[model samples]
Target: MKIKIIKIVLFTLIFIIMLSCITKILQPKDDGAIYGVRTFFAQNNNHNSDILFIGSSHIHCSINPAILYKEYGISSFNLSSGSASFWSIYFYIKESMKYIKPRLIVVDMYTINQGAPYPPDFIFKRFAISMPLSLNKINAIRMEASKNVFHYYINPLVFYHERYSELNFIDFLLYKGRKNRYKYYKHYIPSVKVHLQNEPNIKSIYDVSKLYYKVEEYYLRIIKISKINDIPILFIVAPYVLSNEEQRRFNEAERIANEYNVPFINFNLNYGDYNLDFSKDFRDAGHLNDEGAAKFTRYLGKYLKENYDLPDRRGDPKYYSWEMNAKYHDKDIYNIELKQYTNLNEYMEKVKNADDYVIGITMLGNYQKNDRVLQSIATNFNIDNIYLKNASYVVDNNKLIYSSDGSNQYLFHKEIGSYTDLVIQNGQRLSINRRNYIKTKNGINIVIYDKFTEEIVDNIYLQKY
Candidate 1:
């Protein structure tokens, strides 16, 4: 009887181990907003985060923790899930309490106008997956799921098991080598795409109206939770082109804030304070691009510092992660700005001094002898004979790694990150990981590949006439 009982226990342990491994392998690995937030939050052991930003996409895209730390030394985290309704956010706050003890909670009011009682399955599922297994998670799933709560979300494998076929080699490896990829992300994922918008002119309606009943209930619950924990909470409506209807809803949000004595700020009405340019700051009417987010975050950081009792964690060894995170965030900004340069001389100047990038250059067709800017760039790459029919060069960390002089047909291959192939035939052809980056047919073509991001930053051409 003793031997049989021991066998049963051993069998159960083996089965559980195997199940956990399969579940991890089957789960989708690339949802940054979902997985990144949960993983980073779990990793924050210092519990030094003084503020927490929660809400929909607005919170994640608009509030940059890196900039907050860099500018004001305010320790914070964007513990937000995209498209998450207040129902999920309430539980997110509850789950987060298990880890960090924050002094303030900032709620993004963008989803307050959403009329749905529960968020859509796609949004709910991501939020649910982002939460760790606990009593809070179980309760959240039960309330959020219409039915079959135990079957669908109790174990994510039911939904993700089919992804067994999608599993790649990286999935089996622990960490999946993504440690450095999002190190600077800090749960703040800003959109790099830009969309110009005409400045919106909308006035808040004076008539007081109530929020959607379910939204009001959850919002009140969030306020009550903060009060119970003795943590202050702030509500913000991040800047976006607003319509009359949306402004009315936001006005309702303000009324709630007033009633509860919670601090609230509507950025749509106060865009000028941040010098927000409608044409340049937004990725869309609904979201801010990187530039806009940085501006908004800087303003918000200053406000938090002046108005709140948040500490400056900069230069503190205990908050070294925040400093490192800011560095990585700056690298992301550098990558974005590098692609916007059109002047070859200015572009090369920035490139030549930066040792972190792997640079590739190929000269095609008759060199523009009269164009001094083009000639200067060629000389920088050690193209001694600009009069030569063709030349190709590769620079790693500002050192000449490879060069092909006077060769019309030169095939140069190197592993910048993964691999890069530069072939100068009739015209210069450059590709990174098989993605062609030939911007112009004939000119001095240069490609910048960032070693840190392991991706091509930009491709420029000094067109020769």
Candidate 2:
């Protein structure tokens, strides 16, 4: 009887271990926003931020921590889950406090109208998968997940087991551990697409309906936690293409904020102060693109610096990681800006405006020296003439680094970072690490490199019809 009991226990342990391994392999990777940001915050000592930005996608799309640190020397993080309701935000705030002690908490009020007792299943899945086994998470599962779906959130394998058939090598790799993808952006993702739409003329309606009971309850709970922790909380409404109904809801939120004596700012009504151009700033009706995010972040950074007692850790050795992350952010912004232009003329014009680009312009075969576009580039670069023969020009920033019109004698080589080299031959052939990038040799070949990242951004071949 004793031997049989021991055999049963050993077999059970082996089965449990195998099951754990299978469950991990089938689990999805944590996107930097939902679970990854919280993991990053807990792991990195430098991520003990001065301010915490929390809410829905609006906060993630608008509030950029790198920009805040770069422009104002203020350390911050965006701990936003996409489409998270107030209940989720409350739990997120609870989870975040275990990692970092923040001075101020900025809450986005965009999700105030979400009246559901629980978030959508997809969003709930993200929350459950991201949270570890804790009393807080258990309570969240209990209250937020219904009895029918509770098992699914707790043991995700119940639902995700089918994913095993769809798994690739990435799934096996992630089963071990995942890296912090949002390290550079600090949990911010920038959208580059430009969306042009007329702003809705939403008149303030003071007599709008009251806030949802659950929303108000969770919101107050957040405020209570902030007060208990001695952290100041600021409420904000991020600017978006608003509707009359949304504006009315925001009006109701403002009244609540006033009652709580919390500072509230609705950016939709004060777009003029931020110099927001609706045509170029928005990626969609609801979110700001990179350009718009820059403007909004700059304004907020200045406001925080002036109003709050935040430290400026710009040149300090302790916060050197922030400086490096800022450079990475700048590189991403430059890359996005370069990718937006397809026309050679417009692309050259943008490069001319930015001072941190290494530009290579080559003309191959027979080309018109008097071409208007060539003349415009020559005028901007202050060149005396445009070459009619095969010619190559390398401009570092706005300064002429190297220029050669010879077809055979022109050979330029520069090591990029550690592994790659920028090589040019005879004004026509352009290669990075001997990999051909020029689309055509018959016309003009141009390559642009970002000075901050030391990486090639774009290669363009333009021909006149």
Candidate 3:
């Protein structure tokens, strides 16, 4: 009898160990800011965030907290998910309040018009997966799902069974420690691909007065939560080309903001003030690429400083993390900006002072004339035939020179981050490093960090140009 009891205990222990290993291996990888950073920040956050942002993917991709911290010195975190409804946003705020108190909440209005999809359990899973099982999460699932309560909440294993196929050594080894893909960007995923289209002033027939009651109720709840906590709320509409019908719907959001007496600003209406070039700055009709985000963020940062009582924490020691986050965030921006030079002379000069890199350049075929990608390059950069002259220009001491043996020739662009070797002419190749960012291809991975403080100054998963 004693031997049988001991055998049972040993069997249980081995089974538990195997299950633990499997869980680590099957955990999901970071897809983007919404998919990657929300949980990471929730798990590792120091609860030092002063500003809290909530909503859907628009909030995650548009509001760059690290950029805000760098310029305004206010620390923040983005608690957002893909296709998040007002219902989900309210619950996420509730979850955040359990851990930390923020001075203000910024709400993005992009998802306002769309009603929460029925059977809403799966949409909220991005957040549910990372958060510990708690009453806050339980209540959210109950409200969102309103069915399958047991399968959705009691057992996640059923939904996650398919993830076994996605498992890899990196998932278990975590060689670099719990991976935080967006740690460098402070949760802002920069978009670089440009599709030129202006916001059309088209008339469409969509009723704004008919917004679903559940949507309105959730917005009101968001307002109520802010009032209960006495946390000031601000509503914003990011830059996106909207139809007249969509614009009218956003007017409803404005109306609600006024009813609540909170500050509201629509960047779409004020885009001209920021010098936004629709042809150059947007990743698509709806989203602000990294370049557009920078302009809007800088403008908003200045406005917040002038209007709000945000403090600059640059010199404070307790908030040292903010500075480090800002450094990494800036590194991402520098990497993108470096690839955007429209002038060959300027581009070569910038590249010369920086570290060595490879640019995948391919010749343009017929019909390449209408290629908007090539046309977007400055008109001055055009040539009848790109192959006639070699682009082997290297920067030496901030000067451009043509070199044959260009094995080790890049050196300028001081303080740049990971790069996405965009096609300087038409067809170009790029490199992505272990950090999963665009750094120099097939070369030594170099990190430009603050050795003095042990903080990253730049990271290029490196962006592919």
For each candidate, what is the lDDT? 0.76, 0.76, 0.59
**Tens-place lDDT digits, model 3, residues 372-406:** 43333213222333222222222222322222222
For model 1, the superposed segments whose C-alpha errors exceed 4 Å read 1-22, 29-32, 161-176, 198-204, 360-377, 382-392, 404-447, 459-465
Q: What shift in Å separates residue 97 of candidate 2 from its native position after superposition?
A: 1.2
TM-score-better candidate, 2 vs 3:
2
Candidate with best TM-score: 1
lDDT per residue as tens, model 2, 12-113 = 999889877786677676554454445444446534578889888898889888889877999877778777778888887887888777889999999998
Query: Per-residue CA lDDT of candidate 1, range 1-465, in tens?
Result: 999999999999999999888877776665445765666555744377889888888887788889899889898878777788878888888888878778888999888878866677778878766777788888887778877555787776686867767877667754454455554346776667889898777753565556788788888899999999899999998988777777788888888789999999888877888999987888888889888999999999888899999878899988877887787777777777767777767777777766578777776666546668557766665555555456667788777777776666567777665333444343456766566666766667778887876557788777767
Candidate 3 wrong stretches, greater than 4 Å: 1-21, 31-45, 119-122, 149-154, 173-185, 202-207, 337-465
Quote the positional error of residue 417 for candidate 1 in Å: 6.0
Task: Kindly report which residue stretches of model 2 are placed more than 4 angstroms away from their true locations once superposed.
Answer: 1-25, 29-39, 172-185, 343-465
Q: Could you tell me which residue pairs clash in candidate 1?
A: none
Candidate 1 or 3, higher TM-score? 1
